[model samples]
Target: MQPDDLVLLTGRDHQRVTVAAQEVGLLPGTRARVEGRVLDVTDTDAVVGLADDLSTRYGGADVVISNAVARLLPEESQAERADEFIDVSNTATHTILRAFGPVLRPGGRLLVVASSLGTLGHLDPRLHHLFDGASLDQVEYAVESWRGAIHHRTAQEAGWPVWLNVPSKVAQVAAVRAVAAERRAHDLAASTLIASVCPGMVDTATSRPWFSDYSQAQTPAQAAEAVLDLVFTEHVDPALYGELVRFGKALDWHDGTPPGEQDTMVTP
Candidate 1:
C-alpha cells in the first residue's frame, strides 16, 4: 500500500470520525490521506451508492474495514426489539460485504470487526446448533431465524442480548471464512486476503455505556494499531488469511478451545 493511500472511513456520524481521524493523524493534509463519509450500512441504497462512488473515483479500495457495529443497550434487549439486534449484527455485515466486496482491488485486504464470542466452542450451548456444522447459507438462516423468533415471542424474555451479540459475530467470522474460500477458488490471481479480527473489549464511548467495567479494555487507538499491524505487515502467514485475529495473532477456531485459551498457544 502507498504511504499516501486514501483511507475512507464511513459511519452514521462523520463528524465524530473527523475528530477521530485527526487524532489518528489521518486528516486531509496528513500523510495518511484519510476521508470520512456518512454511511448507514443497514441501508442498501446507501451502501451501494458508496461502493459505486468509490469504484468511480478511485477504481477500488485497497483496504476495506467493516467495523460498523451496533451494541444492545441494557434495557433494549428486554423488549421485543430483537430486529434491531439482527440488523446491527448480522444484516449490516452481510450488506457491507455484498455491496463492497466487488470494489476491493486485487492484493487488497478486507477485515471485519468480529468478537471473541464468535468462536464456536465459546458460544452458549443454547445457540450451538446455529453454528454446529453450519455452512455460510446455514449461518445466514440462523440469523433470520433468531430475528423471527424474537418477533413472535409472547413474553418479555431477555435472551436477545446473548443471542444477538455472539451469534452475529459468529456469522461475521463465518462469512469471512467462506468468502476467503470462494476468493481462492475463483479469484486466485487477485491474491486478496480477507479475515476478521476481535478488538478485545475496546473502551470507547460506544462500549463504555454498555460494559460494566473499562478495566483491561484496549483504547480505540490501541485496537486500531493492532489491526493496522496485520494490514500493513508484509509476508503474513497463509493460515491467518481466513482466520479471526486478535492482538495481532491468529486463533485456530477448530482447536476445540475458546479464543482466550488459544491466545498463549505457541504456533509451533
Candidate 2:
C-alpha cells in the first residue's frame, strides 16, 4: 500500500470524511493528495472523467469512498421531480462502478457509504416503497451486476477488493443482506464485502434538526470513525464478503472488537 494514497470525496458526505481524514493526519494536499472534484455521480461526463483521472493518477486508487446520494426530493419540494429512489441509487452506483472499475488496483479497496435505509424497511413510512412488492431476488440481481462490473473490469489488469457499508434502518439491512447472499451464491470474481452500520439517528447538518430529539443520535465524527475503522482493517471474507454493520445501540466499529469483526465489507 502506498504511504501517500489518493482519496476522492464526492458530494456532501465528503465534508465529514474530510474532517475524519484530517484528524488522522491524512488531509488532502497535506498527507494525501485530496482533489475536490464536484461531479454528479449520475452524470456521464463526471463518471467518465473520474475513471480517466483515477487510471491516470496513482495508476489506480488505494481507496475510493463514495458518499454521493441521489437527488431524492425535488429542488422545490412542490416541484415535480421524480421521487424514484431506486433509480437514483442504482444509476449513481452503476455509473461509479462502470467509470472507475478499471482504475482500482488488485487488493485495492473501494468503500461505498450507503444508508441502512436501503436494507431495512419501515424505518420511515415514506420509504415503504423500497420494500413494497419488492423481491429479494431482484435486488440480488442488481447487486450482482454491480459487483460483476467491478470485478470483470479489473480482473486481468489488477483485481481489487470491493467493500460496501449500508448503515441505516432495518429496511437497509434487509437489502444488504439479500445482496450479499446473492453475491456469495453466484461466486463473483472480485470479492464483494458488505456490512451495515446502523447509526440510529445521525445528527448531521443535512439531517433534520428534530433528529437531535432522539437520545441515541450520534455525531458525524463518531460515524466517520466507525467507517474508517472498517475500511482500513484486513481479514476480509470473500464468501460472506457482504455484511450489514449496524452502528447504534451496542454495535460499533470504533469500540475495539475482534480483527475481522471490525471490518464491514461493502460495494461502492
Candidate 3:
C-alpha cells in the first residue's frame, strides 16, 4: 500500500484487528492510514452495510479484496462440518462480489485471494461444465450441488472432492470468472480488471497447520509480491480477466493442485 492510501481492515477479533492495523505501520517510511472494523464477513447484511458505509463516506472503494476463509482442512469428517466452508468461506466471497461489485469505482479492481488448491481438475471431469458458469447464480449452483452431495453422504460417489475446501475454493475462482463476464457484458471491462490469485503455499502462522511439511513453503512476504504486483500495476492485460493467475500467468481451469499442498491429500 502507498503512503497516501487509506486501508480498512476487518475481522471478527478486535485485538487481532488492532494488531493488524499496527503491523501495517511497522515500516518506518510506510505511512498509510489504517482503520479497523470488527466484522463477521460471513454475515451478508454486515458486509453490505460496510460497503454502503464506504460508498456514503468515501464515495466508493478503488479496490476490493475478499480474503475471508474457514478451515483449510479438518481432521474430523467433512460431512460433520461442511457448512463451515460454504456458509463461512464461500458465502463471504460471494457476498463481497454482490455488495462490492456495484460500488467499485471506474478502473477499480476486485481481487479474490484464493488458494493454489482451487482448480477443478481434482473433481471428476464430467462435472467441470457445471462450474463453468458465466453468471454468479449458475456458478454458485455448482457449490450447492456439492452441498447436496455431502448432505446425501454421496459426495465421493458423485465425483465431488472429499475435502470441502477444494470445492469451496473452486467456487471462488469460478466467481471471478462470473464477475469478469458480467463486467464485460456491462461494458465495464474496458475500465476495470478482475482476477483471482493462488499464492502458492505461503508459510504463515494461519496456514502452516494446514500442511504437514512447510519446508518448501514461501514466507508471507514472498507471497505478497505477486499479489501486490497485480494491485499496483496501473493496468493489467485483458487476458488476465476472470482467470486464476499464479506467479504472473493465468492457469487453465483444469489445472491440478500443487503436490501434497492441501492437507497433504490433493494430488499434484
Candidate 4:
C-alpha cells in the first residue's frame, strides 16, 4: 500500500470490505486512502456501473486487480453448479476486462488474482480450445456448453472432469490472455502489464475447504508477496504480460501440470 495511492476495495459484504479498509488504514505510517464498496462482481451491470463511476471521478485507475471467485462445495459438484461457476469464474473476467481495461492509465497494470490451477494444463487437451480463442463469444459459448454438458451428465464425454474448478480456473486465465492480446495489438505506454497471477494454495476459507492435505498451503500474507511483487515492479517483463504467472514466473501454457502442483515450492 503506497502512501500516495487511494485504494478501492470491493466485495459483496459491506462490513467485510469496511473492516478490510480499516485494517489497511491501521498499517503503520501508511497514508493510503482506502475505500470500500459493496460490489457483487458477478453482476455485469453493477460492475460496469462502478467502472463508469470511477472513470468520472478518477479519470482512470492505475491498477485493476480481479480477486473475485466462486466455488461450490465439494459435495455440490454432482449436484451441478457449472453455470454459476462459469458466471463467477469465467464470465466475470470478461466483464472486468471490458469495464476496466480501457480506462487503465498509461503504464498501468491489470491483474487477475487467479489460482495456480488456472492453467490450460488443468483441463484435458480436448477442452483447451475453450480458452485458446480471443473471442468473447467463444468464452460465452464454452461456458454455455459446459453447463449444458454437466446438466446432461455429458461433461466427461465433453472432455471435462467431474471436478469443475479446473476448467473454471483455466478459463479465468484465458480471459487474461484474451485481454492481453488486445492490449498488445494497440499502442500503450511502457511497463503496462496485463496478466493473471496464481497466488498458489493459500490457507483461506476459499481454499482450505477444497484441499484434503492443507499442510503445503501458504498463509494469505505469504501468498500475497509473489502477487504484490508483480504489482510493485518498476518494469514487468514483457513475456509475462499475457501469461499465467506463479511466483513471479510464467507457467507453461501447454504443460499438463503446473509446477506448483507437482512439488511444493519453498517459501521465500
lDDT of each: 0.68, 0.45, 0.76, 0.76
- Quote model 2's TM-score: 0.55
Selected candidate, larger TM-score, 2 vs 3: 3
Please provide, for model 4 over 172-266, each residue's C-alpha lDDT reduced to its tens digit, 9 standing for 90 to 100.
77778877876773423467888899887787776665567878889989988988898889876877888889998998877665333233211
Cα TM-score per model: 0.80, 0.55, 0.89, 0.89
Model 4: lDDT to the true structure: 0.76
lDDT of 1: 0.68
In model 2, which regions exceed 4 Å deviation?
A: 1-3, 12-30, 70-88, 120-199, 209-212, 238-240, 248-268
lDDT-superior candidate, 1 or 2: 1
lDDT measured at residue 97 in model 1 versus the true structure, 0 to 100 = 73
TM-score between candidate 4 and the true structure: 0.89
RMSD of each: 5.5, 12.7, 2.9, 3.8
